[model samples]
Target: MKFKTAFAAAAALTLATAANAQVGPEVGATVYGPEGNTVGTIEAMQDGVVVVNTGTYTAPVPANAFGEGPEGPIVSVTKDQLNAMMAEQEKQMIAARDAALIENATVLTADGVEIGTVTSIDGDNAIVTLEDGPVSLMRDQFATNETGALIVLATKDQLMAALNGGSVEGGEAMEADAE
Candidate 1:
């Protein structure tokens, strides 16, 4: 029993140490533009991409696009260049979403269970009206099925929770009917 306990404790410590070593860019770190001008601060990292929030706009720069300067992380593009790139990306995304006809598209789970239809799209979120209520699904949480329908990467129970005012990860309850 003593040997087993010691092994378990050592394993736990090793796992914790490994986890702490996977550090990324720190939040609140200063970000510099290509022209070496201060543009924004790091907000967060999402899927290996660094999100920087400038005073006017938030941009996502790929991890590879950043370099360690004397001060901190710096991008190889000026603020105007970053804005232009973001605008182009947004345009392409909007075009793709429009092509998918996400608005009013049937929403289904991975198991082919139908939950609701997308009523509208607002920014990066799609407003879905389930039988119970309305919920907001982020665009990234959905994919285009082979039949051109919108498939939510979640379970029916998860979708229902968002509709019923229960918190769903990466989703929001837009409006719940009072009963």
Candidate 2:
């Protein structure tokens, strides 16, 4: 009788552990909409929010919006519903990005070191005027800090080198523009 009870308890514990294995959706995992169509891929988890990248844009949805499905984590909403939500978020993000006033904005490094100033934004790149010269950086490299200052992942030295027609450690020089 005791042996049976111990085995039952152990099985229950194992099942419980398995069920609670993941507290949220796994990053890089595919997320399906209610229609069983792949809507987006999970990019990350921030402050209990699940960030998903739909083909059009990336948006954060509440963690409770997902549930376990046969294939993977599925969103409770339909594809249209999910798209609508993402579209709204995208509009807000675009509005914020547009209002950032990138031109003449001081660009800083991750350590808060000022590197350059943004001279212009061309499509997916930002033209920055560093100490040496002007260098173009991908838009992804530019972000607004907590205080709303434009920040870049590159350091001052890196920006200077790239601006001077020399390749920085993580930046590529514009060969065509160099000549």
Error of 2 at 32 (Å): 1.8
Tens digits of per-residue lDDT for model 1, 142-179: 76566666677666876567555686566544233322
* Per-residue error (Å), model 2, residue 167: 6.6
How well does each candidate superpose onto the true structure, as a TM-score? 0.55, 0.56
Model 2 scores what on Cα lDDT? Answer: 0.74
Please tell me which predicted candidate would have the highest TM-score against the true structure: 2
Q: What digit string (tens of lDDT, one per residue) describes model 2 on residues 89-116?
A: 6676556555664789887876689876
Native-structure RMSD, model 1: 11.4
Would you give me the overall lDDT of model 1?
A: 0.73
What C-alpha lDDT, on a 0 to 100 scale, does residue 88 get in candidate 2? Answer: 86
